[model samples]
Structures are given as structure tokens and as C-alpha cells.
Target: MMTKFKRLALAAAFGTAVATSALAHSSKETTSPADGSTVAQPPEAIVMTFDAPMRITLIQVTGKDGTNYPVTRTDNMAPSKTFQAVPAALPDGSYTVNWRGLAEDGHAMDGSFTFSVGN
Candidate 1:
């Protein structure tokens, strides 16, 4: 049995613990160059960075028309805090980068983003 005052204290402690745990969970904090950025020259590679370390298994870049870009290189710079992939110079028009990875907590993350190349 618990009194009203005791119940309130227990509730507050539980809430604080939950909130702290949630904050500790791995999440995407930032991305280099930002999500949607226009570059004057074609980028030598495509990189998607995250806050927590991720196990990136696959990454693909495709032209606006859906043609897969030639992947020249792919590297996991830091498996604990970042995931990156590099490719040759892309052609003009819009391009999309599709990535699949496992978060530090073992959860899978899959998403895509598009950017432009030239005039």
C-alpha cells in the first residue's frame, strides 16, 4: 500500500527515468551540407551522417530518371557516430540517395533524399 504523497514521488521518479532513457536513445542529430543543399560543382561523393553510430549496409544514388549512379567507393568512417558513402561525379539534373542502416540500438533505418546537379 502507498499513500498519495508516496505515489506522487514514485510517479515523478519514474517519469524522469523514462525521459532520460528516451533521450539516451540513438537519434540522427545532424547531416553534413544539410538535407537539401545546392552545390555549384558536383560533389565528389555523397555522405549521410548521423548523430549516433550506425551500421550502414547499403547506400545507393540514382539519377532523377531512376538510373543508379556508379558507386566508386563506400566507407564507414566511424561506425560509432557516422556513416558515409562516396561516388564519382554525378550528371546533371536531380539525384536521389537511398540509404539503409541499422541504428546503434539494432533498429533499422531506411530513407532517401534528392538534390540537384547542374543547370
Candidate 2:
């Protein structure tokens, strides 16, 4: 038999556990070119910063016309808080960078950002 105080304590513990789990998943904190920003020159690199270590599985840069641009990753697919990739020379256009990764908590995460290069 559990006392009323014991039941309340158990409920509090359960609530804390749920909240911690929810906050454990990593999230993108920032990007190199910045989301939704237009730059005068093409960005030399694509960078992603996360709140926690993440294993980046796939990262791609695509143009507004559905054309995919190749990006070279130097992270070797290791888990890290920051990931960077060098993209090929880009022309004046809007581009979207999509990425998928696995967070340190074993949860899958994915996000995308858009930037434009023009005067």
C-alpha cells in the first residue's frame, strides 16, 4: 500500500523524467549563411551548429529550380556539435540546404534552411 505522500512524490518524479527526455533531443542552433537571409556573394561553406552532438547522415544543397549541387563533407560522419561542408561555386539564385542527422539521444533529427545569393 502506498501513502498519499508517496504517490505524490512518484508523480513528480515521472513528470520530471518526461520533461528531461523531451529536452534531450538535439536541435539546430544556427547556420552559416543564416536562414532566410540573402547574401551578396555565394557562401563558401555550409555550416550547422547544434545544441548537442549529432551524427549527420545526409546534407544537400539544392537550387530553386530543383537542381542539386554537390557538397563535400569533411566531418567523416562523426558525431559533433558543429558540421560543415564546402559547396561548389554557386550562381545567383535561391537555395535550400536540407540535412538529416541522428542526435546523441538516439533520436532522428532533420531540418532545412534557405538562403539566396544576389545583389
Candidate 3:
């Protein structure tokens, strides 16, 4: 009941679905500061943990008003789990995290999310 073209299309769709399912992130992973946690006191650093190893290159924090937060003097980035940058003490305000890293499969990935400091 299926033409040759139809069969090929179905096979391709099935393959893509399997691949996407295989790459799904597991609960064992984490993102730094955990996507919307407020800090009581500016911690000594900003850190991110991944569900899997990652090769990160650029990590930045920007305020909602468009000011670039100073990465603390400590390097907040690591080759596998986190990206370190020296950010000065983050004042009480809302800030956004912008980051770029290489996924375990070797593809470059990037994302942004915002977090608020004190209430």
C-alpha cells in the first residue's frame, strides 16, 4: 500500500526520531545556579554543571539594563563542567546568563536565561 518514496520518507522520519530520543538529557545533569535560583549573598563564583561533559568557550553575564557584569577575578569556566569568568560582586538586581559551549556530541550550543539577585 506504500510507494517507494513513501517508504523512504517513513524510514527517514523513524531514524530521526530515534536519534533525538537517544540524545535526550537525563536527570543526572545540571545547569549552573540552576536556572532561576536567587543568591542570598553573591557567592565567590558562578558555576554551571552539566549532565554531561562540555567544552565551553564563552560565558557572559549581563544585567537587564544592558550592563555587562564583571566576571569575578576567579576563572569560572572549566573544560568539562563549567565556564569560569571573573565577575565583580553582582549587585542586587536581575541578571541574564549568556553562554556558549560545545555539546558532548561536538556541536556548538548556546543559550540565555535570566536570574534575579535579591528580592
RMSD of each: 2.9, 1.2, 4.3
Indicate the worst ten consecutive residues by lDDT in candidate 1: 72-81
Ranking by TM-score: 2, 1, 3
Q: What's the TM-score of each model vs. the native?
A: 0.71, 0.92, 0.68
Candidate 1 TM-score, true structure as reference: 0.71
Q: Give the TM-score of candidate 3.
A: 0.68
Off by over 4 Å in 1: 29-33, 70-78
Q: Candidate 1 or 2, higher TM-score? A: 2
What are the per-residue Cα lDDT tens digits for candidate 3 across 1-119? Answer: 99999999999999999899677532224555667778766555666666776666677888878998767524444446545555678888888878777777666777766677776
lDDT of each: 0.70, 0.96, 0.69
Which ranges of candidate 3 are over 4 A from the true structure? Answer: 1-28, 72-78, 84-86
* Tens-digit lDDT string for candidate 2 (1-119): 99999999999999999999999999999999999999999999999999999999999999999999999999999999999999999999999999999999999999999999997
The lDDT leader among the candidates is 2
Candidate 1 displacement at residue 45 in angstroms? 1.3
Best by TM-score: 2
Say which prediction, candidate 2 or candidate 3, comes out ahead on TM-score.
Answer: 2
Model 1 C-alpha lDDT per residue in residues 1-119, reported as the tens digit of each score:
99999999999999999888666646665554356666667776666667788777777888878788866544532355665556667766777777777777777778777677775
Cα lDDT over the full model 3: 0.69
